[model samples]
Target: MFQDNLTDLLENVQNGALSITDAVSRLKTLPFEDLGYAKVDHHRSIRNGFPEVIYCEGKTTDQIRGIFLVLMRSENNILATRASSENFAGVRQIAPNAVYYQQARCIVVNPVKKNQDANHYIAVVTAGTSDIPVAEEAAVTAETFGNHVERIYDVGVAGLHRLLAQLDRLRKADVVIVVAGMEGALASVVGGLVEHPVLAVPTSVGYGASLHGIAALLTMLNSCASGISVVNIDNGFGAAYSASLIIKEIMNGCQE
Candidate 1:
């Protein structure tokens, strides 16, 4: 339950539309729900403005299914990351409403009526073709959280002109997530040009000295450009989540 949901519930009670016992029963799972294998945070949306997301890696099919079932009951949007095709098929079988994002290895289900007009837009930029999987992960994660996303792929530092040409589009976004590997210089270059926040993600797509993305991570962290932040190696989901938060803050600020 989010703050709005809880406030509305309380208002209903005070107005005598709902009995006190019934309201209490509905809020019994305000903080969390304990399922033997996992502690589901049902009240995360109430506290954080977004629901708890499920990490599918290293989890069995049954555990994911159980968690998914309980989470769906709350009408909160569902997100499962690092899920395999087989797992997606299983989830689809159980919840036909869920949609699978193959490239990102994610599954999302929307219980609420779709919000056709998205409030904010995010631009996802990638350094090269090899970095697409990570880029796709960031794109899907942001979209799952209700942000409209525009993709700019294979515009790495190797071809600076290509990225320069998109400056107008980049400047229009609420937030920009730059996915890169190798030396990870693209994020710095993008950060220098755009006024919005840039989320840099380093992928494990470089040669031996790349240290499986350490070089990129370090490069991004040491970026001289302002407004650039780096997430862990291959952590596209984390970058997306952070970007979404930044965008949401800007959106809320605009309303004020």
Candidate 2:
């Protein structure tokens, strides 16, 4: 929808249906819009492939709805991370079709399946069942961006056999995101096996000595695997964002 608007604006200028001055007035909201409480980045999709995502953790229900309404006008896929049931309630008031992922704790509005590179896909792996919330966040984010995702859960290193069993499936992904909590060794193991880029998400899902996932974060950062990249603790969204960019590049290069 964001791209559609930009194209429409250019077409209007080219066909002389709208004057340059009039177009400028319409585009004055390009970079951002100030809503007193927040500066909504309306131009985010122009800069990046996806539009700005609402991080609903700290915002009020009214604020989330306000931003959701503004972005809805643009018609792009809308995603709000760390959202509660209350947040979804607020968003649903304006966007009746909005859906909430309970496990992922995310609210999605205008989710359009993007299968430009359906043959290619992302694999979202988790070390244990406890890490699924974070893993779900990554998977949903990728899907919201129109990217295909393969979820492989609870295949941590402790069992070894579980992960080994899914080796064939994991090998086929364009990019792999390994989400782990304790020690975070799963990322290294998967990184060693997969030839593609490996994104490690350290989750806050361990005992007291885990230091609230700091241990896992440090372990992932110091992995012996060559192509492993680590995101912040419980940052499935960040890992997914990077993986989406990788998938985009691969899809574009194939067309070229």
Off by over 4 Å in 2: 1-29
Give the per-residue Cα lDDT of candidate 1 at 45. Answer: 70
lDDT of 2: 0.91
Question: Per-residue lDDT of 1-256 in model 2, one digit per residue for the tens?
Answer: 5557778999999999999988877775554667889888886775676789999988999999999988898766799999999999988998999999999999999877665465799999999999999999999999888898999999999899999999988999999999999889999999999999999999989999999999999999999999999999999999999999999999889889
What overall lDDT, based on C-alpha atoms, would model 1 receive against the true structure? 0.86
The prediction achieving the highest TM-score against the true structure is: 2
Q: What is the TM-score of each candidate against the true structure?
A: 0.87, 0.89
Question: How many backbone overlaps does candidate 2 show?
Answer: 0
- lDDT per residue (tens digit) for residues 174-199 in model 1: 88999999999999999999888999
Query: Please, what is the whole-model Cα lDDT of each candidate in the order they appear?
Result: 0.86, 0.91
Residue range with the least summed lDDT across 10 consecutive positions in model 2: 25-34
